[model samples]
Target: MAEIQPVIEVCDLCKTYYMAGGLSQSVLKHISFTIYPGEFVAIMGHSGSGKSTLMNILGCLDRPTSGTYQLSGENVSDKDDEALAIVRGQKIGFVFQNFNLLMKRTIADNVSLPLIYQGVGDEERRQRAVEMLKKVGLEGYEDRLPSQISGGMQQRVAIARALINNPSIIFADEPTGNLDSKTSDEIMELFAKLNEHGITIVLVTHEDDVADYAKRMIKIMDGEKAYDGLRADYKENQGA
Candidate 1:
Protein backbone atom coordinates (compact mmCIF):
# COMPACT_ATOMS: atom_id res chain seq x y z
CA MET A 1 0.00 0.00 0.00
CA ALA A 2 1.16 3.50 -0.77
CA GLU A 3 0.43 6.73 1.03
CA ILE A 4 -1.73 9.23 -0.79
CA GLN A 5 -0.24 12.50 -1.95
CA PRO A 6 -1.63 15.83 -0.83
CA VAL A 7 -4.53 17.40 -2.69
CA ILE A 8 -2.45 20.60 -2.81
CA GLU A 9 1.35 20.82 -2.67
CA VAL A 10 2.93 24.25 -2.49
CA CYS A 11 6.68 24.61 -2.03
CA ASP A 12 8.81 27.73 -1.76
CA LEU A 13 5.96 29.74 -3.15
CA CYS A 14 6.67 33.45 -3.56
CA LYS A 15 4.94 36.35 -5.23
CA THR A 16 6.19 39.84 -5.97
CA TYR A 17 4.42 42.69 -7.67
CA TYR A 18 6.33 45.34 -9.59
CA MET A 19 5.27 48.92 -9.11
CA ALA A 20 4.92 51.34 -12.01
CA GLY A 21 8.47 52.67 -11.80
CA GLY A 22 10.72 49.82 -10.60
CA LEU A 23 10.21 48.90 -6.97
CA SER A 24 8.53 45.58 -6.16
CA GLN A 25 6.18 44.49 -3.39
CA SER A 26 6.41 40.99 -2.01
CA VAL A 27 3.10 39.44 -1.08
CA LEU A 28 4.16 35.89 -0.33
CA LYS A 29 7.48 34.83 1.05
CA HIS A 30 8.83 31.29 0.55
CA ILE A 31 5.68 29.69 1.93
CA SER A 32 5.10 25.97 1.77
CA PHE A 33 2.34 23.62 2.91
CA THR A 34 0.45 20.51 1.91
CA ILE A 35 -3.33 20.22 2.23
CA TYR A 36 -4.60 16.67 2.27
CA PRO A 37 -7.93 15.19 1.31
CA GLY A 38 -10.70 15.41 3.93
CA GLU A 39 -8.80 17.96 5.97
CA PHE A 40 -10.37 21.22 7.16
CA VAL A 41 -7.62 23.82 7.40
CA ALA A 42 -8.02 27.43 8.54
CA ILE A 43 -5.53 30.20 7.85
CA MET A 44 -5.68 33.08 10.30
CA GLY A 45 -4.04 36.43 9.71
CA HIS A 46 -4.63 40.11 10.14
CA SER A 47 -5.13 42.41 7.20
CA GLY A 48 -2.04 42.74 4.95
CA SER A 49 -0.84 39.29 5.99
CA GLY A 50 -1.29 38.02 2.43
CA LYS A 51 -4.13 35.61 3.18
CA SER A 52 -6.04 36.85 0.15
CA THR A 53 -2.95 36.57 -2.03
CA LEU A 54 -2.45 33.00 -0.92
CA MET A 55 -6.11 32.25 -1.56
CA ASN A 56 -5.84 33.64 -5.09
CA ILE A 57 -2.88 31.42 -5.85
CA LEU A 58 -4.48 28.39 -4.26
CA GLY A 59 -7.72 28.98 -6.13
CA CYS A 60 -5.88 29.17 -9.47
CA LEU A 61 -6.96 32.80 -9.84
CA ASP A 62 -3.31 33.90 -9.91
CA ARG A 63 0.10 32.38 -10.57
CA PRO A 64 3.02 32.69 -8.22
CA THR A 65 6.07 34.79 -8.99
CA SER A 66 8.40 31.93 -8.12
CA GLY A 67 8.44 28.40 -6.70
CA THR A 68 6.24 25.40 -7.30
CA TYR A 69 2.57 24.60 -7.04
CA GLN A 70 1.23 21.15 -7.72
CA LEU A 71 -2.46 20.26 -7.71
CA SER A 72 -3.21 16.56 -7.44
CA GLY A 73 0.37 15.90 -8.58
CA GLU A 74 0.25 18.09 -11.68
CA ASN A 75 2.58 21.06 -11.85
CA VAL A 76 0.37 24.13 -12.20
CA SER A 77 3.01 26.82 -11.95
CA ASP A 78 3.54 27.06 -15.66
CA LYS A 79 0.03 26.37 -16.86
CA ASP A 80 -1.39 28.95 -19.26
CA ASP A 81 -4.36 31.06 -18.25
CA GLU A 82 -6.82 28.89 -20.16
CA ALA A 83 -5.36 25.75 -18.60
CA LEU A 84 -5.52 27.40 -15.22
CA ALA A 85 -9.16 28.33 -15.76
CA ILE A 86 -9.94 24.73 -16.68
CA VAL A 87 -8.18 23.52 -13.57
CA ARG A 88 -10.05 26.08 -11.48
CA GLY A 89 -13.39 24.98 -12.80
CA GLN A 90 -12.63 21.28 -12.65
CA LYS A 91 -10.68 20.90 -9.42
CA ILE A 92 -11.33 23.92 -7.19
CA GLY A 93 -14.42 25.56 -5.75
CA PHE A 94 -14.45 29.11 -4.41
CA VAL A 95 -16.65 30.76 -1.78
CA PHE A 96 -16.06 34.36 -0.92
CA GLN A 97 -16.89 36.91 1.79
CA ASN A 98 -19.55 38.34 -0.46
CA PHE A 99 -21.98 35.85 -1.90
CA ASN A 100 -21.12 36.53 -5.55
CA LEU A 101 -24.41 35.55 -7.01
CA LEU A 102 -26.31 37.16 -9.83
CA MET A 103 -29.04 39.21 -8.21
CA LYS A 104 -31.61 38.54 -10.88
CA ARG A 105 -30.86 34.86 -11.36
CA THR A 106 -32.61 32.07 -9.53
CA ILE A 107 -30.57 29.86 -7.20
CA ALA A 108 -30.77 27.01 -9.67
CA ASP A 109 -29.60 29.25 -12.45
CA ASN A 110 -26.67 30.51 -10.41
CA VAL A 111 -25.60 27.01 -9.39
CA SER A 112 -25.89 25.87 -12.98
CA LEU A 113 -23.41 28.47 -14.19
CA PRO A 114 -20.40 26.24 -13.74
CA LEU A 115 -22.01 23.34 -15.56
CA ILE A 116 -22.91 25.75 -18.32
CA TYR A 117 -19.22 26.54 -18.81
CA GLN A 118 -18.52 22.80 -18.88
CA GLY A 119 -20.93 22.59 -21.81
CA VAL A 120 -23.34 20.31 -20.05
CA GLY A 121 -26.78 19.92 -21.63
CA ASP A 122 -29.60 21.98 -20.16
CA GLU A 123 -31.46 19.10 -18.54
CA GLU A 124 -28.32 17.59 -17.08
CA ARG A 125 -27.19 20.96 -15.84
CA ARG A 126 -30.47 21.63 -14.04
CA GLN A 127 -30.52 18.15 -12.53
CA ARG A 128 -26.95 18.45 -11.27
CA ALA A 129 -27.57 21.96 -9.95
CA VAL A 130 -30.66 20.82 -8.07
CA GLU A 131 -28.76 17.89 -6.62
CA MET A 132 -26.02 20.21 -5.33
CA LEU A 133 -28.63 22.58 -3.90
CA LYS A 134 -30.13 19.69 -1.97
CA LYS A 135 -26.73 18.91 -0.52
CA VAL A 136 -26.45 22.48 0.79
CA GLY A 137 -29.97 22.47 2.28
CA LEU A 138 -31.34 24.78 -0.38
CA GLU A 139 -33.82 22.47 -2.09
CA GLY A 140 -36.94 24.60 -1.96
CA TYR A 141 -35.15 27.87 -2.56
CA GLU A 142 -34.06 26.92 -6.06
CA ASP A 143 -36.66 29.11 -7.66
CA ARG A 144 -35.84 32.17 -5.58
CA LEU A 145 -33.49 34.93 -6.65
CA PRO A 146 -30.54 35.97 -4.55
CA SER A 147 -32.42 38.94 -3.08
CA GLN A 148 -35.32 36.75 -2.10
CA ILE A 149 -33.31 34.81 0.47
CA SER A 150 -31.69 35.65 3.77
CA GLY A 151 -27.95 36.28 3.93
CA GLY A 152 -27.35 32.80 5.25
CA MET A 153 -29.51 31.19 2.63
CA GLN A 154 -27.71 33.17 -0.05
CA GLN A 155 -24.46 31.88 1.33
CA ARG A 156 -25.80 28.36 1.20
CA VAL A 157 -26.68 28.93 -2.42
CA ALA A 158 -23.14 30.12 -3.00
CA ILE A 159 -21.85 26.95 -1.36
CA ALA A 160 -24.07 24.88 -3.62
CA ARG A 161 -22.72 26.77 -6.61
CA ALA A 162 -19.19 26.04 -5.48
CA LEU A 163 -19.94 22.35 -5.04
CA ILE A 164 -21.77 21.89 -8.32
CA ASN A 165 -18.75 20.45 -10.09
CA ASN A 166 -17.83 18.16 -7.20
CA PRO A 167 -14.48 19.87 -6.75
CA SER A 168 -11.72 18.14 -4.81
CA ILE A 169 -10.92 21.28 -2.82
CA ILE A 170 -13.06 24.19 -1.71
CA PHE A 171 -11.36 27.54 -1.15
CA ALA A 172 -13.41 29.68 1.21
CA ASP A 173 -12.14 33.22 1.77
CA GLU A 174 -13.98 34.73 4.74
CA PRO A 175 -17.11 32.79 3.82
CA THR A 176 -19.06 33.91 6.86
CA GLY A 177 -17.57 37.37 7.08
CA ASN A 178 -20.82 39.06 6.22
CA LEU A 179 -23.15 37.01 8.36
CA ASP A 180 -24.26 37.39 11.97
CA SER A 181 -22.59 35.23 14.62
CA LYS A 182 -25.42 32.74 14.66
CA THR A 183 -25.47 32.44 10.90
CA SER A 184 -21.71 32.17 10.90
CA ASP A 185 -21.91 29.18 13.23
CA GLU A 186 -24.44 27.57 10.94
CA ILE A 187 -22.14 27.98 7.95
CA MET A 188 -19.16 26.67 9.86
CA GLU A 189 -21.15 23.62 10.89
CA LEU A 190 -22.08 23.07 7.28
CA PHE A 191 -18.39 23.22 6.34
CA ALA A 192 -17.54 20.62 9.01
CA LYS A 193 -20.26 18.35 7.69
CA LEU A 194 -18.86 18.75 4.18
CA ASN A 195 -15.37 17.91 5.42
CA GLU A 196 -16.67 14.79 7.09
CA HIS A 197 -18.12 13.78 3.76
CA GLY A 198 -14.55 13.95 2.32
CA ILE A 199 -14.22 17.36 0.68
CA THR A 200 -10.98 19.19 1.39
CA ILE A 201 -11.50 22.73 2.79
CA VAL A 202 -9.03 25.60 3.02
CA LEU A 203 -10.45 28.63 4.79
CA VAL A 204 -9.07 32.13 5.35
CA THR A 205 -10.30 34.04 8.37
CA HIS A 206 -9.03 36.37 11.03
CA GLU A 207 -11.64 35.37 13.59
CA ASP A 208 -10.36 33.01 16.26
CA ASP A 209 -13.83 31.58 16.77
CA VAL A 210 -14.06 30.67 13.10
CA ALA A 211 -10.55 29.21 13.02
CA ASP A 212 -11.32 27.02 16.01
CA TYR A 213 -13.76 25.04 13.93
CA ALA A 214 -10.97 23.71 11.75
CA LYS A 215 -8.96 20.64 12.71
CA ARG A 216 -5.75 22.42 11.69
CA MET A 217 -4.80 26.05 12.12
CA ILE A 218 -2.27 27.91 10.00
CA LYS A 219 -1.18 31.34 11.12
CA ILE A 220 0.31 33.76 8.64
CA MET A 221 2.33 36.89 9.36
CA ASP A 222 3.65 39.31 6.76
CA GLY A 223 3.19 36.77 3.96
CA GLU A 224 4.94 33.96 5.83
CA LYS A 225 3.62 30.97 7.69
CA ALA A 226 4.11 31.57 11.41
CA TYR A 227 2.65 28.28 12.58
CA ASP A 228 0.98 25.28 11.03
CA GLY A 229 -0.30 22.20 12.87
CA LEU A 230 -3.17 20.57 14.72
CA ARG A 231 -5.44 23.00 16.57
CA ALA A 232 -5.81 20.82 19.69
CA ASP A 233 -2.59 22.08 21.33
CA TYR A 234 -2.19 25.45 19.61
CA LYS A 235 -2.96 27.32 22.81
CA GLU A 236 -0.64 25.18 24.91
CA ASN A 237 2.34 26.46 22.96
CA GLN A 238 1.25 30.09 23.07
CA GLY A 239 4.33 31.24 24.95
CA ALA A 240 6.60 28.36 24.05
Candidate 2:
Protein backbone atom coordinates (compact mmCIF):
# COMPACT_ATOMS: atom_id res chain seq x y z
CA MET A 1 0.00 0.00 0.00
CA ALA A 2 1.12 3.52 -0.73
CA GLU A 3 2.03 5.63 2.26
CA ILE A 4 -0.19 8.63 2.62
CA GLN A 5 1.49 12.00 2.76
CA PRO A 6 1.46 13.90 6.03
CA VAL A 7 -1.19 16.56 6.45
CA ILE A 8 1.35 18.66 8.34
CA GLU A 9 5.16 18.61 8.31
CA VAL A 10 7.52 20.74 10.38
CA CYS A 11 11.25 20.60 9.68
CA ASP A 12 13.94 22.18 11.79
CA LEU A 13 11.54 24.91 12.81
CA CYS A 14 12.75 27.80 14.91
CA LYS A 15 11.16 30.99 16.23
CA THR A 16 13.06 33.90 17.69
CA TYR A 17 12.24 37.42 18.72
CA TYR A 18 14.63 40.33 18.53
CA MET A 19 14.30 42.72 21.43
CA ALA A 20 15.36 46.29 22.14
CA GLY A 21 19.07 47.00 22.60
CA GLY A 22 19.97 44.13 20.27
CA LEU A 23 18.73 41.51 22.72
CA SER A 24 17.08 38.38 21.36
CA GLN A 25 15.24 35.34 22.62
CA SER A 26 14.42 32.09 20.87
CA VAL A 27 11.18 30.28 21.68
CA LEU A 28 11.26 27.25 19.45
CA LYS A 29 14.46 25.46 18.49
CA HIS A 30 14.78 23.11 15.57
CA ILE A 31 11.42 21.47 16.11
CA SER A 32 10.50 18.79 13.62
CA PHE A 33 7.46 16.53 13.41
CA THR A 34 4.85 15.16 11.02
CA ILE A 35 1.09 14.65 11.52
CA TYR A 36 -0.55 12.17 9.24
CA PRO A 37 -4.21 12.15 8.32
CA GLY A 38 -6.60 11.00 11.07
CA GLU A 39 -3.97 11.46 13.74
CA PHE A 40 -4.87 12.83 17.16
CA VAL A 41 -1.81 14.48 18.63
CA ALA A 42 -1.34 16.45 21.81
CA ILE A 43 1.57 18.81 22.38
CA MET A 44 2.26 19.11 26.10
CA GLY A 45 4.35 21.83 27.63
CA HIS A 46 4.46 24.11 30.62
CA SER A 47 4.37 27.88 30.68
CA GLY A 48 7.20 29.33 28.55
CA SER A 49 7.53 25.94 26.91
CA GLY A 50 6.78 27.32 23.43
CA LYS A 51 3.79 25.15 22.58
CA SER A 52 1.56 28.14 21.85
CA THR A 53 4.17 29.67 19.57
CA LEU A 54 4.47 26.44 17.66
CA MET A 55 0.69 26.21 17.34
CA ASN A 56 0.53 29.74 15.94
CA ILE A 57 3.22 28.95 13.40
CA LEU A 58 1.62 25.66 12.37
CA GLY A 59 -1.76 27.33 12.00
CA CYS A 60 -0.18 30.02 9.79
CA LEU A 61 -0.87 32.77 12.31
CA ASP A 62 2.86 33.47 12.57
CA ARG A 63 6.09 32.75 10.71
CA PRO A 64 9.15 31.05 12.11
CA THR A 65 12.64 32.55 12.29
CA SER A 66 13.87 29.74 10.07
CA GLY A 67 12.51 26.37 8.94
CA THR A 68 9.89 24.74 6.78
CA TYR A 69 6.18 24.14 7.38
CA GLN A 70 4.34 22.18 4.76
CA LEU A 71 0.59 21.70 4.91
CA SER A 72 -0.88 19.16 2.56
CA GLY A 73 2.34 19.32 0.49
CA GLU A 74 2.54 23.13 0.22
CA ASN A 75 5.49 24.92 1.80
CA VAL A 76 3.72 27.67 3.71
CA SER A 77 6.66 28.97 5.70
CA ASP A 78 7.35 31.95 3.45
CA LYS A 79 3.85 32.70 2.25
CA ASP A 80 2.77 36.33 2.45
CA ASP A 81 0.07 37.43 4.88
CA GLU A 82 -2.64 37.40 2.26
CA ALA A 83 -1.58 33.97 1.00
CA LEU A 84 -1.37 32.67 4.54
CA ALA A 85 -4.84 33.95 5.35
CA ILE A 86 -6.18 32.23 2.27
CA VAL A 87 -4.62 28.93 3.25
CA ARG A 88 -5.81 29.28 6.83
CA GLY A 89 -9.35 29.98 5.74
CA GLN A 90 -9.38 27.06 3.37
CA LYS A 91 -7.43 24.42 5.21
CA ILE A 92 -7.27 25.09 8.96
CA GLY A 93 -9.73 25.43 11.83
CA PHE A 94 -8.94 27.00 15.19
CA VAL A 95 -10.36 26.48 18.66
CA PHE A 96 -8.95 28.50 21.49
CA GLN A 97 -8.87 28.33 25.29
CA ASN A 98 -11.51 30.98 25.40
CA PHE A 99 -14.44 30.36 23.15
CA ASN A 100 -13.94 33.38 20.92
CA LEU A 101 -17.56 33.82 20.00
CA LEU A 102 -19.32 37.10 19.53
CA MET A 103 -21.60 37.56 22.50
CA LYS A 104 -24.17 39.45 20.49
CA ARG A 105 -24.51 36.86 17.79
CA THR A 106 -26.71 33.78 17.94
CA ILE A 107 -24.97 30.43 18.17
CA ALA A 108 -25.94 29.74 14.58
CA ASP A 109 -24.59 33.09 13.45
CA ASN A 110 -21.26 32.54 15.16
CA VAL A 111 -20.87 29.23 13.41
CA SER A 112 -21.79 30.82 10.11
CA LEU A 113 -19.15 33.53 10.31
CA PRO A 114 -16.47 31.54 8.51
CA LEU A 115 -18.78 30.68 5.68
CA ILE A 116 -19.27 34.35 4.84
CA TYR A 117 -15.60 34.62 3.88
CA GLN A 118 -16.00 31.67 1.53
CA GLY A 119 -18.80 33.52 -0.27
CA VAL A 120 -21.38 31.09 0.94
CA GLY A 121 -24.79 32.70 0.63
CA ASP A 122 -26.74 33.47 3.78
CA GLU A 123 -29.20 30.62 3.30
CA GLU A 124 -26.56 28.00 2.69
CA ARG A 125 -24.52 29.37 5.54
CA ARG A 126 -27.48 28.95 7.86
CA GLN A 127 -27.97 25.43 6.61
CA ARG A 128 -24.37 24.43 7.14
CA ALA A 129 -24.16 26.07 10.55
CA VAL A 130 -27.21 24.32 11.85
CA GLU A 131 -26.01 21.03 10.42
CA MET A 132 -22.68 21.38 12.20
CA LEU A 133 -24.36 22.40 15.43
CA LYS A 134 -26.49 19.29 15.20
CA LYS A 135 -23.38 17.20 14.73
CA VAL A 136 -22.01 18.68 17.95
CA GLY A 137 -25.27 17.98 19.83
CA LEU A 138 -26.32 21.60 19.89
CA GLU A 139 -29.17 21.33 17.41
CA GLY A 140 -31.79 23.12 19.48
CA TYR A 141 -29.49 25.71 20.98
CA GLU A 142 -28.80 27.54 17.76
CA ASP A 143 -30.77 30.61 18.63
CA ARG A 144 -29.07 31.22 21.98
CA LEU A 145 -26.29 33.70 22.53
CA PRO A 146 -22.87 32.74 23.86
CA SER A 147 -23.55 34.50 27.13
CA GLN A 148 -26.62 32.35 27.61
CA ILE A 149 -24.74 29.07 27.46
CA SER A 150 -22.51 27.38 30.01
CA GLY A 151 -18.76 27.40 29.45
CA GLY A 152 -18.88 23.90 28.09
CA MET A 153 -21.69 24.76 25.70
CA GLN A 154 -19.79 27.83 24.54
CA GLN A 155 -16.82 25.61 23.82
CA ARG A 156 -19.12 23.31 21.90
CA VAL A 157 -20.18 26.28 19.86
CA ALA A 158 -16.54 26.99 19.14
CA ILE A 159 -16.05 23.43 17.99
CA ALA A 160 -19.13 23.64 15.80
CA ARG A 161 -17.83 26.84 14.25
CA ALA A 162 -14.48 25.23 13.65
CA LEU A 163 -16.09 22.31 11.85
CA ILE A 164 -18.37 24.38 9.67
CA ASN A 165 -15.39 25.12 7.42
CA ASN A 166 -14.62 21.42 6.96
CA PRO A 167 -10.89 22.06 7.19
CA SER A 168 -8.37 19.25 6.97
CA ILE A 169 -6.91 19.99 10.39
CA ILE A 170 -8.06 21.49 13.70
CA PHE A 171 -5.63 23.36 15.92
CA ALA A 172 -6.88 23.76 19.46
CA ASP A 173 -4.89 25.70 22.06
CA GLU A 174 -5.80 24.90 25.66
CA PRO A 175 -9.21 23.89 24.48
CA THR A 176 -10.43 22.91 27.92
CA GLY A 177 -8.51 25.38 29.99
CA ASN A 178 -11.53 27.05 31.50
CA LEU A 179 -13.80 24.09 31.95
CA ASP A 180 -14.32 21.83 34.94
CA SER A 181 -12.93 18.32 34.89
CA LYS A 182 -16.13 16.63 33.78
CA THR A 183 -16.71 19.26 31.15
CA SER A 184 -13.14 19.00 29.97
CA ASP A 185 -13.49 15.27 29.58
CA GLU A 186 -16.68 15.77 27.60
CA ILE A 187 -15.00 18.22 25.28
CA MET A 188 -12.05 15.90 24.76
CA GLU A 189 -14.40 13.06 23.93
CA LEU A 190 -16.01 15.31 21.35
CA PHE A 191 -12.60 15.92 19.85
CA ALA A 192 -12.00 12.17 19.82
CA LYS A 193 -15.25 11.64 17.97
CA LEU A 194 -14.23 14.21 15.40
CA ASN A 195 -10.89 12.48 14.99
CA GLU A 196 -12.63 9.17 14.49
CA HIS A 197 -14.28 10.70 11.47
CA GLY A 198 -10.81 11.35 9.92
CA ILE A 199 -10.02 14.94 10.86
CA THR A 200 -6.46 15.57 12.01
CA ILE A 201 -6.34 17.12 15.50
CA VAL A 202 -3.36 18.85 17.11
CA LEU A 203 -4.06 20.36 20.48
CA VAL A 204 -1.76 22.05 22.99
CA THR A 205 -2.27 21.61 26.71
CA HIS A 206 -0.25 21.32 29.91
CA GLU A 207 -2.49 18.78 31.59
CA ASP A 208 -1.69 15.10 31.36
CA ASP A 209 -5.39 14.21 31.48
CA VAL A 210 -6.01 16.21 28.33
CA ALA A 211 -2.91 14.83 26.63
CA ASP A 212 -3.99 11.27 27.31
CA TYR A 213 -6.94 11.69 24.95
CA ALA A 214 -4.75 11.89 21.90
CA LYS A 215 -3.29 8.82 20.22
CA ARG A 216 0.14 10.46 20.05
CA MET A 217 1.80 12.93 22.35
CA ILE A 218 4.60 15.40 21.59
CA LYS A 219 6.37 16.95 24.53
CA ILE A 220 8.13 20.25 24.11
CA MET A 221 10.68 21.50 26.61
CA ASP A 222 12.30 24.92 26.45
CA GLY A 223 11.40 25.33 22.79
CA GLU A 224 12.72 21.98 21.67
CA LYS A 225 11.09 18.69 20.76
CA ALA A 226 11.60 16.49 23.81
CA TYR A 227 9.46 13.46 23.09
CA ASP A 228 7.33 12.27 20.19
CA GLY A 229 5.59 8.87 20.21
CA LEU A 230 2.40 6.97 20.89
CA ARG A 231 0.50 8.09 23.96
CA ALA A 232 1.07 4.69 25.61
CA ASP A 233 4.81 5.00 25.20
CA TYR A 234 4.73 8.52 26.53
CA LYS A 235 2.79 7.29 29.57
CA GLU A 236 5.24 4.47 30.17
CA ASN A 237 8.12 6.91 29.96
CA GLN A 238 6.24 9.22 32.26
CA GLY A 239 5.99 6.34 34.74
CA ALA A 240 9.68 5.46 34.60
* lDDT, model 1, position 19: 96
lDDT of 2 at 163: 88
TM per candidate: 0.97, 0.98
Of candidate 1, the 10-residue stretch with the lowest lDDT total is 231-240
Best by TM-score: 2
Alpha-carbon RMSD of each model:
1.1, 0.8
Candidate 2: segments with Cα more than 4 A from true spot: none
Compose the digit string of candidate 2's lDDT tens values, residues 159-211.
Answer: 98888898989999999999999999999999999999999999999998999
| lDDT tens digits by residue: candidate 1, 1-240 | 999989999999999999998999998999999988999999888999998899899889999999999998889988999999999889989898998999989899999888877889999988988899899888877788899899999899889988989898999999999999999999999999999999999999998888888999888899999999987678668737
- How many clashes show up per model? 0, 0
